[model samples]
Target: MLNLETLSMDQYSFVANAFSFGLAVMASTTIFLWLMRSSVAPAYRMAVTITGLVTAIAAYHYLQIMLSWEHAVSIETGEVVATGEPFNRAYRYVDWLLTVPLLLIELILVMKLSQQETINKSLKLGGAAALMIVLGYPGEVAETIGTRMIFWILSMIPFLYIVYQLVIGLKESVDKQPENVKGLMHIAAYLVVASWAFYPLVYLLPLAGVTGGSAIVAVETGYTIADIVAKAVFGLFIFTIAVRKSEAEAGASGTSASKKA
Candidate 1:
């Protein structure tokens, strides 16, 4: 069902390998954190579990992507031939399609929001995120820079909406978070902004006249870096937020019970 062609690694091989390794680490660490930390508040546990699933899915996809990159170029008698029919440049978008919404959902779950609020925000934000990824794909496969930019700009419409929901729409809710984890929530939100913002900058490089191997390097390496930060590092912050919030809630419960006695 997927490409299994084996060819020489290109300049992007090392970066691809690194990204694969990062995904592996993200998957293992988040799953381990979820399994071993079962005593946390139920909502927080669910959040961590979702984070694990997100990373695990990304890791699987990245492995395929890495292999695809390996076969995209071949060295033949001192000549390099491009041969990535199954290269699957869309793997990243596929990964984003699945994981981006989950990322937002994990943050929402960690906040322990009301049922109606949770469903509403999750649907709106997650739907917007999925649309953003779906819209970006056509641009990615576009044959010309002009068409690509048009699609890219169209994709940004949803992206900007997601950002607005994260920053302004959720401001009051984040403010109501436990004192200990309130700033952590903002940090998590800002990390999402910072990391996700890097993607478009990388995506636009080729349109800006960055051609040849340098463009490949910039696209691959820059995206890999952003992926690490957005998924791996951002997942860590989510874990921290969950743990801290769970502990704070547990302590508050104990205090309330003691007061009742």
Candidate 2:
């Protein structure tokens, strides 16, 4: 990795476009989820509402993120120069801290588990998600390899714990989901696992000998894409679960009415 106080236009263009694209994705998803909320049952509507809220938070943060990226770089003589305004990466961490726990809560709520189970699981999982984000930030800002490694290890304690809870602890709840949405729940859990896992790998780019301009581009682009999948696309999954469950219950109620008649 070359020292990159001044990035070539190619490098700067790549990251700028990434931030713009992420903003578009997050904003669009927020609107779409909210507009479609009426399609689900009242009980499941809150899940859809929070799904939109997650993207709304993401969209606002993405706007800040784009502005930060722009402020940090200047186009002069067709080159991208550092303007001495450091890019504020904290916007992303703040976004994650607010949205990650809600992401878990939305999924748990849409599952329609018993009230006690939903409360218990959401409280535990939400705390763990917040801890995971908090622990990862120190490593993200650390200059030394040892400090980064230590924080990375501390962070993974919560990350792996969340994954285990999803894959094992929540398996029975997921299995009890309506047959129509059961398979979808499984895919949603895996989507959370896969997309959330990408963050750690991106965090390790510097450790993997990727640095300078290339690392900046990779980190920005990689994170933008992951947020799209984890929030926007996953919001669609929650909407789907809500719609399917709503339809299933409606059909059951109609059948019960016919039998009574």
Candidate 3:
């Protein structure tokens, strides 16, 4: 069994700090949008509100991990050992649980902006999101760390669906000659695909013993950077598109009203 204790302090610190920083950025962006609710479109305002809540939850998970690390270091040196339970082993799964639903909601909202009318898009998205969350429970409750691979495989289904939706939206925007929408769609496509592609590679390779502890740390660092790029930069790109769309709609409505008068 691969032991986290075998890793150096620097390795542990690097992963923890990077993940914490990424989650912090995610949380801050969500909070910022929540604060500016009056200026955003109604759909986007709701999306941001959901994003804020999930981001805050994920941040709490990372914060708990950080505190656990601090406790571990003190214990190693014969200082008073912190005795409380660390985060539930299931918490990481729960973090993903919260994230997948918000992602589906965001995608559905984007699809609406793209002129796709489906009678049951919401129901489909919600059902898929719930399935992913349900599937996560087995991995969360597994007795050994090795069982996480099963979770990864199960989680990949929804992740791939999200990537597929983003790719289709990107292509549709490009073909339709909507420059603003195209730009945002391209960013979303790249971010979603890039961020999710690392999961299986990191977990599977480490479990297979193709990589050691340091390599796991490196993979984690890369994952953290990818997440930061996705949540911070790509998130802002989506926000810009929402604002531009609202402005265009407002201008068009004004023009039509004037012509009618």
Candidate 4:
């Protein structure tokens, strides 16, 4: 009973191509990091691996969307686009579930590498944040009217946690009087906030469908773009910070060892 005529093939293709390209870029970056693993710290190496895995999962999610579009189009012509239901929605929810915790863990690892005095606090907060995200997953499996409400509430937890960490990091960077660190922290905070800002718009778009409008297509495309920006681009920025912190730590350690000798 879905209308394919409401969706534009050209638009769908463009979004699909963009997502595929972004995934390819992420995959390449992951392989490159693996090749240069020696230059990265052990903690950061784990972060890279986690990031790569999440990226791969995200890539698969986009591919599903693309396939779903094809299926929808085929169904319009009385043909089967593919088998089963579109798993794109499920993939996206699961992607967020995995990404949220991985990001917090990466941030904690970076703080430790930077030798921050409050590393213990950061670790505790990160653990709590991860737990909140984990709790959100049950909503993904929920069935009925209560499911969406639970999902929305649970999803908000990560947003709040990121905001808290962003404020803390920014304040700490300012107190330390380090221009480079402050600049990086400011950018990271902005990206985290920006990612959260897109969620509400994506959530509301579905309401347009009640009017028999083509909001479904718009919502799908909007989310695809948001994920690319938040998960792919913002994620790369986070990884860069981790890499820088690791290099700084390694350099300092070498210098200290030489001085002791």
Q: What is the lDDT of residue 78 in candidate 2?
A: 90
lDDT of 1 at 28: 79
Highest TM-score against the true fold, candidate = 2
Over 1-261, each residue of candidate 3 has an lDDT whose tens digit, in order, gives 334564566676677688678768877877776776555556466655665565666667667656655554433563333344442335455666666566556544643443343325555655666676676577645656667668867967975665666576336533453455666666665776776576556655545655555775776677567656645665666566666655555566876435434
Ranking by TM-score: 2, 1, 3, 4
lDDT of 2 by residue, 1-261 (tens): 223454679888888888889899999999999998887878998899999999999999999989988887778889777778888898999999999999999999999888998899999999999999999998888879888889999999999999999899999898888899999999999999999999988888788878777777778899999999999999899999998998888778986435434
Which wins on lDDT, candidate 1 or candidate 4?
Answer: 1
By lDDT rank, best first, the candidates go 2, 1, 3, 4
Question: Per-residue lDDT tens digits of candidate 1, residues 19-82?
Answer: 6776677667667766755756666778888888888888887787787766765656655566
Top candidate by lDDT: 2
Clashes of each: 0, 0, 0, 0
- The C-alpha local distance difference test score for the whole of candidate 2 amounts to 0.89
Tens digits of lDDT, candidate 4, 1-261:
333444455554555566566567556655654565555567667766665665666766666656655554443354324334443455566666666556555544544446564465456555655665566556545554366466657767765766766677446643453344546756766775687578654653333333222455466656666776666676576577666766566666986435434
- The TM-score values for the models, in the order shown, are 0.89, 0.95, 0.75, 0.70
* Alpha-carbon deviation at 259 in model 3, angstroms: 18
Model 2, which residues run further than 4 Å from truth?
A: 1-6, 255-261
- Taking all chains together, the TM-score of candidate 4 against the true structure is 0.70
* Segments of candidate 1 deviating more than 4 angstroms: 1-10, 76-79, 84-86, 255-261
lDDT of 2 at 24: 94
